[model samples]
Target: MAGKFIVIEGLEGAGKTTAINTVARVLNQHQICDLQFTREPGGTPIAEALRNIIKNGLDNEPLTNKAELLMLYAARIQLVENVIKPALKIGKWVIGDRHDLSTQAYQGGGRELDRIFIETLQTQVLGNFKPDLTLYLDISPELGLKRARSRGQLDRIEQQSLAFFERIRQRYLELAERDNTIVTIDAAKSIAEVTAQIETTLNAWLTN
Candidate 1:
């Protein structure tokens, strides 16, 4: 049986990682099925190295909007071929911390890169692979940055101005609206509340 694919998406510091972890734990407790949680950019060795470059920095001009999109898909292809595909071929429920939605949010939304180009690259490079469901954690960039700051120093992308993040969040909302598979969630609530909401939604979704 093909396993379910669940992806979590949001601006930096939106608590997507925690949500994905919690969802996996809940599934395990119920013995629902094989559950696995992972992140992109560094899912595979080659990709992880590229991930470091993206997250850290390049000595030259910061990655251009188009270059950023290309690097992302480069890492994505690696993630899918080496990590995600093999796991899904079996019965493992794949819970990803982020996916193509980031392309829409970060590259398309944040950088104002070419939308047609991004979509075309996705179709050509990624092929038919896509998440079964995406959980979009909706939160203001300010609150999200506050949380992120509490954790540690900001990375390259995180260090970008609030205006950039705001654009990214808006793009996320747009993608969620256009795609039925994407479920937008108000992440302003407490972690427990958000987890409860997700569980309730998933339970309903799985039954039908």
Candidate 2:
């Protein structure tokens, strides 16, 4: 059987790292150990470069919304072609920190970009490529950002207004509702509770 792709997605501080660890533990418990880890706008030299520019502006030049969106797709394609696809072809399960869904939520919804343009670019760049399972850690912008701030300085995207994150969360929930592959977890719960939820959900999916 071919390897599966699992992605963890959420706002700035929705405990994605913890969720990913849980997923890995569950997969390992199932005796599925071969894994390839990746992060969007990264996982390759070219994609990493794009990720830097996307996270931090260059030479104080203002990056336009459309340009940012285009760069994201470019980096995504690079990671997909150079890393993700090859790993999956070799039967290595890929655990992704983020994927196309981030762009859909952050850029399309948070940045208020045109849905048609983003969808067209998605088609042109990724085609049918997507994660087999996506775990969305749902949390309010206020709480999420508060937690993010505790970690340290915020990145460019993280520095966005609360309203921005609200839009992103709304978009994430909207998308997750229609997609059976996406499982939303209440991130405001205790860490133990969140871990239990992830374990239960992933174990059920793995068994099915």
Candidate 3:
């Protein structure tokens, strides 16, 4: 059987790192050890360069919303074609930190970009490529940002207004509602509870 692509997604400080660790542990428990880890907009050298520009502006040049969206696609395609696709072809399970869903949420919803345009870009760049399973750690923007601030200085996107992240979360929930492959977990819970939820959800999906 071909390897599966699993992605973890959420707003900043939504505990995605911890969730990813849990997923790896569960997969290992099932004796599925061959794994390829990736992060977007990164994984490939080109994608990493794009990620830096996306996270931090260059030469104080103002990055427009449209330009930002296009950059994201460029990075995504690089990672997908160069890293993710090859890994899956070789039967290595790929665990991704984020994927196209972030664009749908951030650009389409938060940036208030045209949904039709974003969808068209998705088709052109990614086609049918997507994760087999996406775990969305749902948390309010206030709480999430508060946690994010505790870690260190906020990045460019992270420094956006609370309203921006709220839009992103709303989009995430809306998308997750209609997508059976997406599992939403309440991230406000304790670490132990969150881990249990992820384990339960992933185990059930694996068994099915």
Q: Can you give the TM-score per candidate against the true fold?
A: 0.95, 0.99, 0.99
Give the lDDT of residue 54 in candidate 2: 96
Stretches off by above 4 angstroms in model 2 are none
lDDT of 1 by residue, 117-201 (tens): 8889999988888999898999999999999999999888899999999999999998899999988888989998989888876
Ten residues in a row with the worst lDDT in model 2? Answer: 37-46
Question: Could you give candidate 2's per-residue lDDT for residues 78-165 as a string of tens digits?
Answer: 9999999999998999999999999999999999999999999999999999999999999999999999999999889999998999
Clashing pairs counted in every model: 0, 0, 0
Top lDDT hit: 3
Error of 2 at 175 (Å): 0.4
lDDT of 3: 0.95
lDDT for 89 (candidate 2) = 94
lDDT of every model, 2 decimals: 0.85, 0.94, 0.95
